[model samples]
Target: MEKTTKHPKQSFTVMNELVLPNDTNTLNNLMGGRLLHWMDIAAAISAQKHSNRIVVTASVDNVSFKQAIKLGDVITIEALVTRAFNTSMEVRLDVWAENIPSGTRHKSNEAFYTFVALDENGKTVPIPEIVPETAEEQELYDGALRRRQLRLVLGGKMQAKDANELRAIFYKD
Candidate 1:
C-alpha cells in the first residue's frame, strides 16, 4: 500500500485559553505547569491531525518562559507538525500572551514536542509523511532529523557517533 502524506498546514492547530486566578501562581502570573499542560494539548491535536491516529507525547524539548502571562490574559498556542518519522513526529508550538486591556500580544514561549502514534493495541504505528510548502516549513522539516538524533543520543538511546547530523556539529573542520 502506498504511504499517505499530509502538508504541514493540514496539521496546523491553534488553541486559545483565558488565564484565570486558578491558573495563576503566587506572583499572579500563569503557572509554568499550566502553560505546559495547554501546550501539550495543542501539540497532541496537531500530532493526531497529521497521523490520523491516537498519539501520545514522547518528549518535550526546551521550553523557556520568556514572558510572564498575567491572570486574565489570553494565551494562544499555535502548533504544527514539522516532520514525521515512521511512528514518531515532531510538533512545534508557539505561545503568545495577549492582554485584553491593551489589545497587544507578545510571544511568551516556544518549544518542540515529540509524539508517537499508537495502534488500538497500543503498539507504535507508522504515520503519513509530511510535505512542507514554505521555506520556513522546509527548514524545520530538514532539521527535524538532526534534532531527533540529538535527543536520542542525549537520552542514551543512540550512541554519539551514530548521530550523523549531531556529530557534524562538533567534528566539522
Candidate 2:
C-alpha cells in the first residue's frame, strides 16, 4: 500500500482562558473540568474549519494532564485536524500554560477529540479532505493516526459487555 500523505489543514482556535482563582480548586491548580471544556471548544473549532459547518463532539479520548497550571497563567488551547472518516474528524489539541511571572510556557495537557460535522439539521455531514504539506505535518498526521487507533481500542474495551471480550480486544496485537 502506498504511504498516505499527510493533509495538514489550517490550524483552528478552539478556545482559551486565563487561569484564575475561581477556576482552580483549593490547591490553586486549574480544574480538570475546565481544561476539558477548553479542549472540547478547540476540537469544535477544528471541525468547523474542516467542514465550514457546525460540529458536535462524538467522543473525547486519552486526555492526559502532564502538568499543572497555577493561578495567573494564560492557557492557550489549539486544535488541528489530523484525520477524517466520513463525517467524523479527529482533532488533536495541545494546551499550553504560560506563567505570567516567568513568561515561560509548558504543555500542560493534551487530548484527542472526535467530532462529527453537522448540517443545519444537526445530522452528520462530510468534511473536506486534509493535505499535510511538510514533514512535520506528516509526523503530526501519523501521531493522530496512532491516537485514533488507541481510541478505538479503548472505546471497544469500554463498551464491551463481556469482560472476556474486552480483555481480548485490549490485548489484541
Candidate 3:
C-alpha cells in the first residue's frame, strides 16, 4: 500500500471555532454533531482540490473522538487526499485542538471520508489520479486502499434492510 512521492500535489485547510457554552449540550463539552459538521467541511475542501469539481460526501468511515475539545480551544483541521478512484476520492483528516492561552495542542479526532466528484447534473464525475510524491504520501495511499477494501467487505455484508436504511441516510433527495 505504499507509493513514493517527492512532494505533495494538493492540500486543503479548514478552521474550527472553539466550543461555546451554547454549542454544548448539558455535558459542558462539544457536541458530536458539531464535530461531524466540521469534519464534513474539511473533507469537502480536500476532495474538491483533488477533483477540481464539486464534491459531495459519499460516506464517512469510522470516526472516533479520542479527546474532548473544550471551550476556548481552537480546532484546526487538515485534510489530504490519499487515494482516488474513478469518480471518488478518499480524504484523511487530522483534527487538532489548540488551547489559546497556553499554546498547547492535542489531537482530538481523526477520520476518513469518501467523496465523489459531481457534475452539474449531480452525477458522478471523474477525478485526477493521485500520484504519491513521498514515502509518507505513498503509505497513506496504501492505507487508504486497505480501508477501501474493508469498506467493500462491510458493504457486502450489510443486510438488505440495513443497506437500504444506510442509503436513505446518505442519499436523501
Candidate 4:
C-alpha cells in the first residue's frame, strides 16, 4: 500500500562515488557523462521512494558544470523529490566533489530531473503528492512548476502561450 501524500524529506537519497581513472578524461576531471549517469540513478531512486513505484526518467533540465571534479575525488550526489504531479515527480539533485586526502570539498552543480511512475504493464500511474515542510522546500516546490513548463515548451510538448507561470515572470501583463 502507498500513501497518498509524502514529504520531500521522506524521499531524500544520497549516493557517493569515487572518481576513478576510468571516470575521468585526459584532463583528469570527472567526465560529464559519468556525473550525469550518477545523478540520474540518485534522482530515480528518490522519485521511486516518493511514489513507491517504478519511475522512468521523463526529462532532465539544464545542467551546467560549474566546477570540475578531479580524479580520486569522492562525488556525493544528494537527491529528493521536490514536487509530484498526477503521475510525475520533480527531483532536485545537488552534486559535490570532495578530496578526502586534501580535506577539501567543492560544489559541482544542481540539476532537476523529472520522473514518471509506472505500473506493472509499463503504463503511467498516479503518484503521491508532495508536502513541503520547510521554506526552502516550499520555494523549490513552487519553482518546479515553472521549470517544468519551460521544459515542456522547449520539448514541443506545450506551447509558449500556455505557460502562465513563465508569462507572469516575463510578460508581466
Candidate 3 or 2, higher TM-score: 3
Model 1 agreement with the true structure over 1-173: per-residue lDDT tens digits: 01223454548888889999999989999999999999999999889978889999999999998989999999889888999998999999999999999999999999999999999999999998888888999999988999999889889999988998887878976
lDDT of model 3 at position 13: 56
Computed on alpha carbons, the lDDT of every model, listed in order, comes to 0.90, 0.75, 0.78, 0.89
| TM of each candidate vs. truth | 0.93, 0.79, 0.82, 0.93
Clashes of 1: 0
Query: What lDDT tens digits, residue by residue, belong to model 3 across residues 87-142?
Result: 98898888898988998999989999999999999999887888888899898887
Deviation in angstroms for 161 in model 2? 18
Task: Give lDDT tens digits, candidate 2, residues 94-140.
Answer: 88999978979999888778888888988888877677777876876
Segments in model 3 whose C-alpha atoms lie over 4 Å from true places: 1-8, 157-173
Winner by TM-score between candidate 4 and candidate 3? 4
Model 4, span 1-173: residue lDDT tens: 11222354458888889999999999999999999999999998889888889999999998989999999999999887999989999999999999999999989979999999999999999987888888999999999999999999999999999999989998866
- lDDT (Cα, 0-100) at 48 in candidate 1: 90
